[model samples]
Structure formats: C-alpha cells, structure tokens
Target: MANAFERLVEKMDRATLDRMGKPVLINDVGFVAVESHLIPEMGPLTGDGISLVIFSSDYKPRRNDQTVWDGQSYIVTRYQSFNGKPQVWLE
Candidate 1:
C-alpha cells in the first residue's frame, strides 16, 4: 500500500487522541494522515497502536475493551467516558 498525508473533511464517527496526544478524528477537521500509519488501523486486530496526533480536546469514544486493527476491519478494545468537556490520556 501507499502512504501520504490525506486530509479528512468531515465529522468522524469517533474522535480520540493519537500517540502525539493530538485530537484525531476518523475524518473530521481535515487533518493530514499517512496511509501506512492509519491503513494498518483500518483492519481488525487485538492490540493498540501508539498515538499519532497531538491534539486532545474533545475525545469521547463510544466504547473501549480491545481496540484492534486487522488491516481490513476494526474493533473497540477499551471504553472511556467524558464529562461534557475535553479530556486526553496524557502521561
């Protein structure tokens, strides 16, 4: 597969923070992404990937138990809730 910084111009289903602790949405805010970086996360796996983004403000995921990226499908691996504010998992 190829890798490049693609821009997402739409609201994503789930918004969370990346390895860099940045606010990253599936397809919101139109940020730059790498195919090699996110493509792997597009599948079904039983592990967690390191954070990539550096913005953590409005991260409210739907579920959490075991986030997996199997290359073709994805699954929730953990669950985290928010309180009407922006919160990121730093440190």
Candidate 2:
C-alpha cells in the first residue's frame, strides 16, 4: 500500500536524521539539533541568501533570527515547511 510505504520511508528518514543531525544555536538562544542540507545551486534565493533545508525533531529557527554556519553569520529571512520538515532561507 502506498500509505504503508510512505510511513516506512518516513521512519527511515527519521532514523537517518537522528544519526546525522547536530545541534545548532539560533540567536545564541534557541537551540535546534537538525541535519542541515545546503542548497548552493539556488544562487541566493533572496538575492544574497543562503538556502538550507533543516530536518529536526525538536525545534526550528524563526524568521529574522540569526545563526552562524561554517563560521559565517546568516540572517534568517524565511521559514517554511519542506517535505514535512523545515527549510530556512537566510541572507
């Protein structure tokens, strides 16, 4: 059944995320432990933005929040659900 297969895929994705996710800080306050995937091909979705999809089981950063990834500071410009997970667009 398609539903059963979807559930199985979800479980597998969760397991992968649990094993690969790492803790990241937001504005030095909110902490989210998620597996972040970078989208460098978009060439700044917000005209000087960095697009990243974050898979987390607990928290997600809000819009206008700040984070430092790979030693570079970024500003969160957008937050939306992608494939049932959080996708963050930063500038």
Candidate 3:
C-alpha cells in the first residue's frame, strides 16, 4: 500500500509543484512547500483571510508555533496531515 507521503506526492502535479511550490526553511528544515503570495495584515487592519498554506510530505507545525519562510516569520494557526500531505495554515 502507498504511504501518506507517497499519496501526497502522487497527487501533486508537476506544473503546480514547479510553479507554486518552492523550497523554504521550516524550523530550519528545508522543504518544498506551498506559500501564499498574499500577506495577512496584522492588528485591526487584519482581514478575514487565510495567510499561508504549506504542502509538505512530512512536516507538521503546532498551533501558535512560529515558522520562517522567505526570510519572514509567521505563526501556525491550524494544520492537518491525516490524509496525504501535511497542510499547514498560518496566521
């Protein structure tokens, strides 16, 4: 049977991975994950929008933990990795 990581990789298309997915350092670990171009605003200016989504084979972030991407820092607000690839949502 295919493992979770394998399933995730299989589901990812070459074009999407090549275009949108970029390698970034997560907790200093290198991973090819998806990052959103739109940056969420802080404070009262912040709107109802998801900040970032990370697609990785085997990386999970605890809620409220800080993560760095593209030289910027963000906090992980939600995540799920039961199906295939781990999907992390940043706030």
Best by lDDT: 2
Candidate 3 residue pairs in backbone clash:
none
lDDT of 1 by residue, 1-91 (tens): 3234222211231333222222234323323221123355588744544322322344344433122222222333333333333222211
Count steric clashes of candidate 2.
Answer: 0
Superposition error at 84 for model 2 (Å): 1.0
Best of the two (2, 3) by lDDT: 2
lDDT digits (tens) for residues 18-51 of candidate 3: 8887766667677777654444453353455444
Question: Better model by TM-score, 1 or 2?
Answer: 2
lDDT computed for candidate 3: 0.63
lDDT of 2 by residue, 1-91 (tens): 5698898988877786678655555677544345445565945533445556665546565888887665678888878887777777766
Model 3 TM-score?
A: 0.57
For candidate 3, the per-residue lDDT at 40 reads 42
lDDT of 1 at 80: 36
Q: What is the C-alpha RMSD of each candidate to the true structure, in Å?
A: 13.8, 4.4, 6.0
* TM-score for predicted model 2 compared with the true structure: 0.57
- Where in model 1 is the C-alpha error above 4 Å? 1-54, 64-72, 80-91
